[model samples]
Target: MTVYATFDSPLGELLLVGEESATAVGGTALVSLSLPGQKGAAEVRDGWRLAPEEFEEITAQLRAYFAGELTCFSIEFARGAGTDFQRRVWRAVEEIPYGRTATYGQIAERVGSAGAGVRAVGTAIGRNPLLVVRPCHRVIGADGALRGYAGGLPSKERLLGLEGALVP
Candidate 1:
């Protein structure tokens, strides 16, 4: 069964969806992290529960991240919807360090695709379900300009600024 929770952060409201893990020993693997205005709205699904307490660790980590004290997210994340190529792109995005940025071209290359794959990489990024936790905001335009984000360009800029990648 899946459970979800809502938490407030510097970037605004976040929705965490996951299911209790049987193998992890008192752990839940996150399935998705949707931003303030994104889908995955707060509702009790048939096999889902609204359990905020079950996500205390994740909330604490996110709070520390917003406060600049956490650089890595350790919560286990379950695989979300995506194609194999998109999953490869998402993994590449995860490798982008905190307070740094990468271009779509770079990500495409990292995923072992041809020069024309930049657009494909961007499309995969656009579909990323984990948002900030996967660090999709760290992907910028080739010319060093902020680009599209699931949470909007303004939110993208704000996140980069908070991470010290861009001056506030």
Candidate 2:
């Protein structure tokens, strides 16, 4: 069974879910954006985790990311579902290091396409359920303006701000 842990971040309350492997399946909400049940449902952790590194370190990494001390994550986990295009987009998202952001058009370009592919890229990005754990928040509008954010625009603003990206 997948195990879930809840932690608080400067962004907001976050829920981390994983398998026997501690990599995350997904994380939800950010700084006042978390409404009750706003995030995907997950099993709450009230028992001991069976193996691997301390959960605290996972929590610590998340904390570090939000604090701007961390950029990339080394957690070993899996995302639940997707198509090849979606996976490609997610992988491209992973390639984006911290403190930097990419536009959907640019992501499309990276995936060997063009501005016309921005919608498809945005579609794939919207399918990102992993939140900050996967760094999906780093994707933005081509004009450097905030577009649609699943976790809410305010949280999106916070994440970009934390990463030192100027928001319009």
TM-score of each: 0.91, 0.78
Q: Candidate 1 lDDT, tens digit per residue, 1-168?
A: 788998888778798888888654247888888888754334446878888877888888889998889988887877656899999999999999999999999999999985999999999999888888899999999889887787888789888988899632
Give, for candidate 1, the lowest lDDT window spanning 10 residues.
36-45
RMSD of each: 2.1, 5.4
- Local distance difference test, per candidate? 0.84, 0.68
Error of 2 at 97 (Å): 2.0
Which stretches of candidate 2 lie above 4 Å from their native place?
22-54
- C-alpha lDDT of residue 6 in model 1: 86
Task: Look at candidate 2 and give me any clashing residue pairs.
Answer: 11-31, 12-31
What count of clashes does model 2 give?
Answer: 2
